[model samples]
Target: MGQQVLYETPQISIRYDDYAEWLHVEWIGDQDYESVVSGATKMLEYLEQQGCRKVLNDNTLVTSMWADAAEWGGKEWFPAMRAAGCEYFAWVYSSNVYSRLSTDLTIQYTAAGIVILTFDDINIARLWLQQM
Candidate 1:
């Protein structure tokens, strides 16, 4: 699907795919709690603006653990995103073991309001989001 860049930084890039009606968020490099929150907040804004229900959250380039933000992501951000109209989430895991652990931690605290699937491959994640 064709996409338009909604936001970008050294740490993250948020893109809107109008054709598929989803937000594609790529989180790059090491991330701390602050960077995760910042990137997620920016993504939320674009998701609301674009009226997208699905999110392809790619963490393939993330190199550090950010477990400190896991609870906040699952408890706070996910709910707010749901409230903002999100329904499906496809998360592409980081290859780094620590980053993968952090991603798993976030899922532990996530509620059942939305459909969420995690994948090791971005292509698989994209396909899942497209199907949703």
Candidate 2:
């Protein structure tokens, strides 16, 4: 499988896998609302440009709370992602309790039209995306 980096920052890295035809989004270090929104917006843009339907969202390295972005993620970003042709979203949770709570909050706010599954293991997330 070939992968290309679509976007990268200290806070996030987004890559596209040619063989799998999915986006691999890795969130790094701490997160603030601005950083989360910025990274998510970029990911959405790439999903539109690539016309990919699946995403593997990895947050295992995240260490801070970003609850502030939760509502926006569910209410705005996710809907935009869906419109951009996204079908499957596999989110790997961070070990941090706060980060996990934030992830749960975002999921709670999300609507039910798209497939969004959460996992504690990155490998499982990847496997799920592959199956999709």
Candidate closest to the true structure, highest TM-score: 2
Report lDDT per candidate: 0.92, 0.94
Candidate 2 residue-wise lDDT, 1-132, digit = tens: 899999999999999999999999999999999999999999999999899999999999999999999999999988888888999999999999999999999999999467999999999888888988
What does each candidate score in C-alpha RMSD? 0.9, 0.7
Q: Write model 1 residue lDDT over 6-118, tens digit each, in one string.
A: 99999999998879889999999999999999999998898899888999999999999999999999999999999999999999999999999999999899994989999
What is the Å distance of residue 81 in model 2 from its true position?
0.7
C-alpha lDDT of candidate 1 relative to the true structure: 0.92
Supply the global lDDT for candidate 2.
0.94
TM-score of candidate 2 against the unseen true structure: 0.98
